[model samples]
Target: MTTQPERLQHLLDRLLRGVLLPEEAEQLAGAVRDLERRADVSDAVAKGNLRHVKQLIPAVRAAEARVHELEAEVSRLTAGQCTHSLAICETHHAKPVPGCPYPRCVAARATGRAATA
Candidate 1:
């Protein structure tokens, strides 16, 4: 059996040639109405999706702002603390903490070249 699009094309071609039978004309009209109904449903679905996204925007923005605030609080709390790993200070640039076992931390303390926060 031919697909709906193919059937529609055939009917359209017959109509254009001015040789479409009454039944074929009815089929063409039905296909056009079905296409219009599908378009209307799709438009309604899209509008609904847009409304949902609009409703979510303020909540999303508020959550993002809270995340930024928490990050800032973490930064404030961690200020003046060593940011390097306990095992190694790769850059040897982190602030030295007393009794740290890492050689870089010891060397930085000895040389007084450790970075200050």
Candidate 2:
């Protein structure tokens, strides 16, 4: 016979797959809250053995830290590229820089008159 947790897990799985009955939806929520309380684990993670879950915490933290670092790097690179493009746009004085890849810059260059000294 399946245990309550197992049945609750099955219900939760069905709920996640969009197949649960209306009553089962309520049941799934209650089961999830109760199990989460009992396990003292994050709701973000639905299911795992205790040992594995414990092991994953640090790994998850590390991966999240790495994600933050990469996000910062991406932001910095994008800002730098935008600044470079803007500078080039200003230098060319509304014209596209000869080798600049921005289509708007190219359009501006095509339409813009030469800058007066």
Candidate 3:
């Protein structure tokens, strides 16, 4: 059996190896990990507007995943992107956008147009 520190070390190693660590294994889970947190997002996603919501989901997931991947890479260059529960990104756009940084995500709001970039 691995000690907690050993397990944590293994988890970090896996992060370096481009593997996703399980939620149970993370030393700390981020805000995105919280289930009860009511997100403040755009009306399109919250109103269940399909046109704008579809494109945004993957982009958001890719960005968030990329951030974690980068953090793992900075400390260890051997790691790559891992799916794990993060793959549940497939289930997201699950939250609405309180604010969009993307021009398309923003344009979709400004004119009520399907903003795809």
On lDDT, the candidate that comes out on top is 1
CA lDDT of every candidate: 0.74, 0.65, 0.49
Candidate 2 lDDT, tens digit per residue, 1-117?
Answer: 989978987897897898999998888788878877867656434545666888999999999999999967664554346456665444544433344455554565577754211
Task: Give candidate 1 misplaced runs (Cα > 4 Å).
Answer: 80-117
> Candidate 3 regions off by >4 Å?
1-48, 77-117
List the candidates' TM-scores in order. Answer: 0.67, 0.34, 0.24
Of candidates 3 and 1, the better by TM-score: 1
Question: Would you give me the overall lDDT of model 2?
Answer: 0.65
lDDT of 3 at 87: 33
Q: Candidate 2: where are CA atoms >4 Å away?
A: 1-48, 87-117
**Model 3 C-alpha lDDT per residue in residues 9-96, reported as the tens digit of each score:** 6666776777755774454244234322545455436777786688799999999999988865542321111122333222322221
Q: Provide the lDDT at 53 for model 3.
A: 82
Q: What value of lDDT does candidate 3 attain over all alpha carbons?
A: 0.49
For model 1, residues 1-117, the per-residue Cα lDDT tens digits are 999899999999999999999999999999999999999999999999999999999999999999999966654433323344643444433665555556666677788876332
Clash counts for the predictions, in order:
0, 0, 7
> lDDT of candidate 1?
0.74
